[model samples]
Target chain A: MELLMAVSIGVLTACGIYLMLRARTFPVVMGLMMLGYAVNLFLFSMGRLATEAPAVIGRAETHADPLPQALVLTAIVIGFAMTAYVVILIIRGRKTLEHDYVDDRVNERDHGVAEQGLSKRAVAMPETPASAEADGEPRP
Target chain B: MSSHLLILPVLLPLLAGAVLLLFSGARLAWKRPINLAACVALLVVAVLLLLRATEGGAQVYVLGDWVAPFGIVLVLDRLSALMLVITAVLAIPVTLAMSAGTDRTGQNFHGLLQFQLMGLNGAFLTGDLFNLFVFFEILLIASYALLVFGGGRARVAASMHYVILNLFGSALFIIAVGLLYGVTGTLNMADMAVRIAALPAEDVALVRAAGLLLLVVFALKAALLPLGMWLPAAYASAAAPIAALFAIMSKVGLYAIFRVHGLLFGDMAGPLAGLGQSLVWWLALATMLLGILGVLGARDLRTLLAWQVIVSVGTLLAGWSLGTPEAWTAALFYMVHSTWMTAALFLIAGVVVARRGEARDSFMVDARIASPVVGLAFLAGAVALAGIPPLSGFVGKALLLQAAGFSGDMTIFWVLMLCSGLAGLLAFSRAGTSLFWRGPVAEVAAEQPPMPLMPALLLLVLSVLLVAGGGPILDYLAATADAMLQPADMIRAVLGDRYLPGGA
Candidate 1:
């Protein structure tokens, strides 16, 4: 069960990172939601693996670690609130800027916004001429 | 019964806020109740906490029957209570001065502010790491709303930067907590302190690394040097009262640094002893240099004051890094003093902005409407901030220098002092020339200022009183300083390890 949870977290993290790098505000928002899921699971798994166990004491067996479970519960609630807030903020930003793309306007203005979360490999290298032409950019 | 005072400090404002929320539509009526309750309750709490800290060493109040790591505990030690009291003392007047004349905001404003206070107090008093993070989020979320309460383009843009930075810090904090819990299997600060101390020499580095990661997050929150570019822009653009409230925020980070370094992870004899030397002290030196340059280069009064706050962070870090008992006292003393002084400075800038109706590039824009009282208040704040003798700032800096010692190797201390002195002269001289010496704004129609002179006068008087009473304050601080440096006191308090060998 712990391994499954860990695997799920890794999957969520990869998807989150991928979507977070997208140019639109919507994808970035979705990416944050995915990252929140991963964080929640990661936080929950820190107490180590316990299988076939309830969080409460029972006649047949002992309970799982109640502390981590409790922490995970709080994180879930806080995460939901944060996601709601970010969604609203994105909507507001879109309305104010009159654009749906996160990379528009503010990113162009701030300059650092685009560079903030990029992969080092992507940042270090410009696209090759064939790739640039394929992507419909100037080869030179 | 006295222990009950602890609950009241948190509960009173909370109750007041809830009541205010019910009257959200009442407009003008909401202001008086919120102002009065916030003022009285905070004053009472601040005084009571100080008195209790002086009389009884440190008291822990368990929320219910559960003990140890299971139940929540509110620990009221000298350091915790001192921070709480200072927060309250500054919070009340600033709140009153802010809400006095402004158009009524949403009734939720009072509730959010009080809730933020609750979170701050909780963060300081909490005995568990998870609880600390929980309260941090509470304060942060509420601060987000408060910072952008009355919407402006500048406010939103600046607040975006603020939120993103703090959110990143919070994420890092959570990750660090998860890693620490993985290793130790405990979240209680006291229990973790004991376990970490008992670890084998080889295993200690992981814990120290965890400590450093956590420190990095706090450093971000505290706006240390290079990490502080977000501060001046965000703070200078916010509403004055909100900016004033934020003066308390960085202290929470500093408080965490104090607690973790002095109590929980305080194996100063281990590999971590040099950690402060390389990380905190050097960072502090850089912070001072950058802060001075920023203050000098800043184009507006609000941003200039904001940059000064960054400078104060440097001062506090330098003092804390000294690690001597005397050094701790100086750092702690400077912490409280800077909070009030910065709040007052921001308030004065707000007043200046209101009168001129424009953000002036320098302090020297208009003079006729500048009230004598306001100028006097700014002068007092400037004098205190500059470390001029007979003011509170002088005492704080003097103690810091004494603590660091005047040995030739103390170049950091000397440079910081020299910069502060020069900055002090620059700040006051500019204000004097621009505010008092310059001609009045004869063209614009005059409007009566919203703030009652009473509150600003009260703050000025308090700043002066602190200056006069520095001798006794110094003595009291010295004792607390000694308590902080003595590893045995902290270990026993946190770990209950009296029977363990080498525990002392």
Candidate 2:
């Protein structure tokens, strides 16, 4: 069981890195998601792979260690919110810059569209939940 | 009751952030006072904490009265208190500058500022490794929005790189924490230190790998070379004050290395003593050498300041890698000097951006604001940043060189430190000539209100104080370094009398 878990994490991490290295925002976001999954699983398995064991300490002779479970939950929540944010940001990028490429140097034109956006102070906030998206601060 | 002071640095900002978020749509007249008031209160709290930290032992605030090693904890010592005070000082000017109405460029400027403060304060105070990760995310999220708040194409591209790289870093941080927990069976740093002091032979390799990963995570945060490619563009693109506030962010990474590595792998650790020191020493030199080269290559004032930040990190890391109390003191002193002065430079750069209509601090001599005040402030910041004589930078670098003089390989450290200083001098000289001397003269009639210049001047005042008080300051930092190098009382303070070795 431990072998299976470790190998799965390794594979997920490998895939995540590969995707993250791609040149587009979409793949990068996907890569972050994959990396998040890998980390979550790795954190969960830190307590070791236990079956039919209660998480509550002192519940049984061979109960599972519960700290890693709590850590994993927090990581998952933060990761999910972060992914949602990256999606909003890239959408805005796509609209304004007209390209989804990660590195703007590869295919960007004059940055005038955004500088026009910058020239005014009271420019309306973009139509994203960024103002409300401080992410959940899970105090586990 | 006094111990409660430890938690206020984290809590004041969290509460204030929530309140400011509620008023995000209100008139600036309403939000400005609130932001300034909160920042002043935080500065007071930070000062009190620093005063208390100077008394002796680490002040441990057990959250919810949970026993040590069993729940989250906030621990304030000399090092963390210094961090809190530096952050609070930086926050004041940043808040003051933001209040000048540059904040209208975004929707919740004050709230994001407060949240970023909370994250920095919390990261400094938290004793548990995982809690640090939480604080890092809070800060990163706030920084992300703040970086992209003003909405520029250059900024979005920069934010894209910054966000993705940080997300990757977050994953690595979690993996390291998980692995550390798996090996040591604890998360509290003091307890982990106790455990690592007596770690069994079989688990040594795993702990070493975990420790190095933790180091890498921090190095990435500190912008140690190879891991820091995202910094220059991201920082240079962000609105000026935001980039200025971020000066301390890299220090947080350096701080973690100081706190964690010094505690967990100090000389007392049975077999793992000095685990990452050699690697840090070598890479830090390389980081410094390359960072100076970066300064030479920068085409704009903001990018030059960004690369200078990388250079400061390298110098500080060199001091830290020395593994001596003297070196730590020097590093701390240099850190205090550099963080404030760098932010002052950025704030001044913001002034330049506002005043120079079309050139926008691009280093080309197209147009110039001939305000003597701007030129004076730029000279002060430049002189201080480049380690010129009679400034705080020179004193700080002297202390570092003095400390490094005692190390085994002083030759390379000395050469690199001197070369970095010379590089800074040349870059700032070129930037200065182009900015002040070569640019075409312009009418000063349409000058923007000097409100933003207020904060930059204030930061310069702080830098001057650093030079005037260098003697006493180094003495105090020496004591702080003493506590970090020897963590017995810190551990005892956190674990109470029930502390045990190799026992849960």
Candidate 3:
């Protein structure tokens, strides 16, 4: 049972990492979600596996670890809160910047320029004149 | 009485915040009155608890009347009670300095502040790992809201990064706790300590792995070197009062690191050998070097102060890693002094930003309004933060250096201590020149009201007094540090000495 759990976490982590490195915001979000799932499962498994058992000891007693279960439940709720928040933020990013890609270099550079007392407009150094035309092109 | 002391620190602020939330309508402004009362009450409780600890040893309060290894517990000893007092002293001033008319982020500003106090108090007192996670979440969520309170794009963007990094850290933290529980078959700290100690040397590697996870998670939270990327950006973008509050939040990370390292992991020291101390020392050195460079490069005054916080973290780690009574004394002194000065520095920055305008680094204040109060406040804060003599910061750093020197690891000690001190001084000097020395614009210079000098003055004086009256306080703190390093008192306070090797 422990071996199965370890294998499950390993696979979850690989998938999570792969998705996290994607170019788009949605995929990255999904990757983070996967990572969260993997983490929760991994943490829960630390309490050891219980077979056909209630955590409480009684007539039908096969003792299980309740602490990890309780903790993971809290994690799930917190994870949901975080996911919802990040998703909304991504949507806002798309609306304002008019791009769905997770490349926030444009925003970060602009902020840095602003902090340096330079004009944001002046700091908007286009990579290429052709890219400037591409910048106006709408994404699906 | 001792057991009851555990509930008061956390519960009082929570009740106040709840009431404030309920009475949000009308021009009541009840938050201030309630918060002030709660802070004073917390301070009193902390002092009484400290006294009680000195007289009677450690105090453990089990929640729901359940015994250890079964139910939740809150432990208060020299370390915790001392931290609680420092937290309260720092908090009350920030609470008083909060401007009611101000809109900090989108949340009900004062309500979240009180809730943060609740979380901080709880974190300091909790004896269980799961409860620690709960308090951490509470603190971070409230911090996120406070960080973005101004609705600025930068703050909002920074909040996103802060939230993500912390969520990742939390996931790591919980996983480590789960692993420890699985191996030890218990979540109670004292119970786990005994079980881990009983394990043979060959089987302790698993415990070390778990300990490493916890260390990483906490280092991230404390903004230690490699894992600290999110801090300066996030902290610099937040409002002043909120940033001040975060000064203490960062310390919570160190608090956990000390507890986990000294208590649970310390028992297994035989197997790990010098591995634990070495890991901490290496990290501390990296953190110190990186933080100083970061401060030197920081252009904005607030960002400079933010980097100073990271440097302070290095000092904390270095002191704790020394693993000696003298070193612990130094660490404790630094913790108390740093928390105060950091909070004051941030608040003073806020006063400057408020006068100069919202463009942050570029605002020009009117001489009339910014001259007397705000300018002097900034100057005092700058001097105190730089660890100039006759202030709490100087005394704290001196003790830290003394301890490091005592360890005879003089190379790391001299390099980190001198560099951190120089970086801190240069950062504050630049800020002071920009803020107080520079003349204000002609137009608003006439209209400017005298700066609110009282708060910063009070903070500086208190710091000075702490230094002046250091003899007794130093003795008390040193003894507390001695007690923490030994852990016999702590263990006895939790589970009696019957579980000890030579049963008392």
Q: How does each model score on lDDT?
A: 0.72, 0.88, 0.75
Candidate 2's displacement at residue A94, Å, is 1.5
Worst 10 residues of 1 chain B by lDDT: B442-451
lDDT of 3 by residue, B1-504 (tens): 655777888888788778777877624365567767877887898788878877776789989988776888898877888878888887777776664334322446767877888888888888888788888888887787788776665675667667767877877787788778878877777777777778666668777788888889988888887888888888888877778888898999999888767777674446753345788788888888888998888887789888889888988888888887887887888887788888888877766665665334532332323466666666667666767776777778888787776455568777777878888888777666665666553223323222243555556677877888888888888888776656767777677778764675
Best by lDDT: 2
C-alpha TM-scores of all predictions: 0.88, 0.93, 0.89
lDDT of 3 at B338: 84
Where does model 2 exceed 4 Å of error? Answer: A57-61, A108-140, B406-408, B443-451, B498-504
Docking class of 2: medium
Winning model by TM-score: 2
Error of 2 at B248 (Å): 0.6
lDDT of 1 at B230: 82
Residues A1-140 of candidate 2: C-alpha lDDT, one tens digit per residue: 88888899899999999999998899989989999999999999989888988998677788999899999999999999899989999999998778999988666323443334343322454454343222211112
**Could you tell which candidate, 1 or 2, scores higher by DockQ?**
2
Better of 1 and 3 by TM-score: 3
When sorted by DockQ, best at the front, the candidate numbers are 2, 3, 1
Query: What's the number of clashes in each of the models?
Result: 1, 0, 9
